[model samples]
Target: MPRDPLSRLQWLVFALVSAVFTTVYIPQPVLPVLRQTFGVGEGTASLTVSAVVLGIALANLPFGALADRMAIRPILLTGGLVVAAAGVVSALAPTLPLLVGARFVQGLFVPALTTCLAAYLAKVMPAERLNVVMGSYVSATVVGGLSGRLLGGFVFPPGHWRWAFLVAAALLLAATLAAYVGLPVEDHEKARQAEGVRFRDVLFRHDLFRIYCVSAGGFFVFSSVFNYMPFYLHGAPFHWSTRAVTLLYLSYIVGVVAGPLAGRLSNRIGNGAAMVVGSLVFGAGLAVTLIPQGWAMALALALVCAGFFTIHASAAGALNRKLSTGRGRANAFYTLFYYLGGTAGITLSGHAYHLAGWHGVVALAAGVLLVPLSTGLVEMRLAQRDGSATRSSVARAR
Candidate 1:
């Protein structure tokens, strides 16, 4: 329990975030099943998945504002409890409407912790080691999303999606309890020394705004592609079953390694260069999905996973680096756009899937990747300019 950068508190936050994010996608892999079980249409069944994202988009800024004032630990504990309660309500839902309602409530509170984590670390951790901890946290999100998805579609017995909710609730409860017990006690005096960040200052940098908007576009493509992937696999030449389709999410395993690798790469090169590499790789993977074969699709997904995480980790690092002050509000605004992209992706692309088929969705994702790639190129130039300036300054000093 020393005040080292990689303390037990960091790991506790990592674990807690993973558990909280599981709720984000518990119903994702099982959307088709929910359709049949509840006798709802494709769009209606999808509401079970999209509702939570919408809630997260709606709540991130408001809850982010809340995190600026309150201590993060107590807020996290309360949010976890609320999430656990919502899970129980979801498990007991006799109808889809009730289940969607429960998920919305869960989404509303979970950001209470997710939004605060980066800012809290910025306050407490030494600057040099922040990327390692943040990378671990991003990796945890991949694990949680994959875990909840697999739990819904494969781990639980058929017709027992409720068990998935129960297990998720248990994990949430455990993460909350452990965080409360094990996390380092905050230095209230140190915390009080700095009042909350002014979001206006965080936004004053035009470069930061470009990065944030580009991030939203990147996540938008990522969300739409993943949201409708099962449907594509379930149709035509492949005709995969639910379990088979759910197993594809395991490809997200690549993200576990990609997060840290991307972070380290950004640490060496620049965040913008890392982002460009990521976008190129991600676009390549997305393009590969045009192939109609199963193994090819799987390989494509793996590439997609790796590329997406690379962009995600690097972008987050760049954002945090820029927000030397007001880390809380800065991160909150970042997540605000992030989840908003997710909400928009699911809503708009669901219509594309209905009218134009999976290829249309792919086409859209490919087009959207341009926003990030363009911004990433601009960032690379900026980083190069800054580095040259630093070198010249050093030479002059000598």
Candidate 2:
């Protein structure tokens, strides 16, 4: 591909990714409003978010497999259409259950847009460029996530949240059409062959499993805090309005910078060291959120977004670095674990919030953060041992 067109294509990928995340998170900032609109409890209202995550987790494998077997053009076209249609249905639905169901349908096809697209990038891009491009990919997600929150909570007037869905659906539709026209079609025969690679083949690899755990663990803590934050601010000494709460999501901009920077850091120091640093930042930020002051909360969230995306970008770069083939399946499993963690976090944290409020959610999240922290420690040990072995072999050869 020509450099100019490739640049355009990269932009298209970013826009499509941004659209997907925007649709996925559109309901998040408005959870409190949804709870009242639907006349349901916080736990039930949360289903709007978790249900989509569950759908993504369930469908990722098949989409990942398809990514290896099929060209991505049709996949993007179909997935975008279905998700957009579902968004429209969600907007039009008369009841909360229908809205949740539509979101679930949207989730089922999301892998086609996300995991499959990621695999496509891995296949098409040069190995040396993967980490940087993937970092840009993660930054796109930050834009999309922040856009969704603002659209849902701030752009549309109160009680008109359905318009957010409608606008998101339209944006998805536009991005889908643009990607369909803009993305290059790959020849499957020319793409790296997966051969007999099985889903379990990637899932069971120790190194890859640890990377997957990072995905799950990092998102678990991040999702738990953001998913339930509306309720936390609404009832507390803060009593922040919907728009005020939405503004806090601006902290997400830190992730746009963090993603690419973490990618570079991983390149310099290795993924294990990067992960260790990220986990420390994450844990500290989570601890800081305990302060009741509004400025403290904003500062805490910036740290949280920075830390989470740092772990996330490094993990993504690390996973791709370990892969020579079957990247579609591997990336799929990464996303499957990622959203599953989000789903689990939201579900479990809902109970925590109901029982003991934000503190309970924090307590649960603190326990979960141990997964990434421990995984990072183990990764650092393995990297050190491997480096020592390499040096010894080189010394003997000399």
Q: 1-398 in candidate 2: lDDT tens per residue?
A: 33786577778888899999999999899999998898999999999999999999999988877777777778889999999999999999999989999999999999889988887887777777766666557778889999999999999965899999999999999998998887777777855355587888998999899889889988989999999888989986989999999999999999878877997898899888888889888888888888999988898999898889888878888898889876667777888899999999999999999999999999999898888878878877988999999999999999
Residue pairs whose backbone atoms clash in candidate 2: none
Clashes of each: 0, 0
> Weakest 10 consecutive residues, lDDT, candidate 1?
188-197
Candidate 2 lDDT (Cα, 0 to 1): 0.88
Itemize residue pairs with steric clashes in candidate 1: none
Candidate 1: segments with Cα more than 4 A from true spot: 1-7, 124-132, 189-197, 387-398
Task: Please provide, for model 1 over 63-105, each residue's C-alpha lDDT reduced to its tens digit, 9 standing for 90 to 100.
Answer: 6666555676787788889989999999999999999999999
Candidate 1 lDDT score at position 232: 85
How close is every model to the real structure, measured as TM-score?
A: 0.91, 0.94
lDDT of candidates 1 onward, in order? 0.82, 0.88
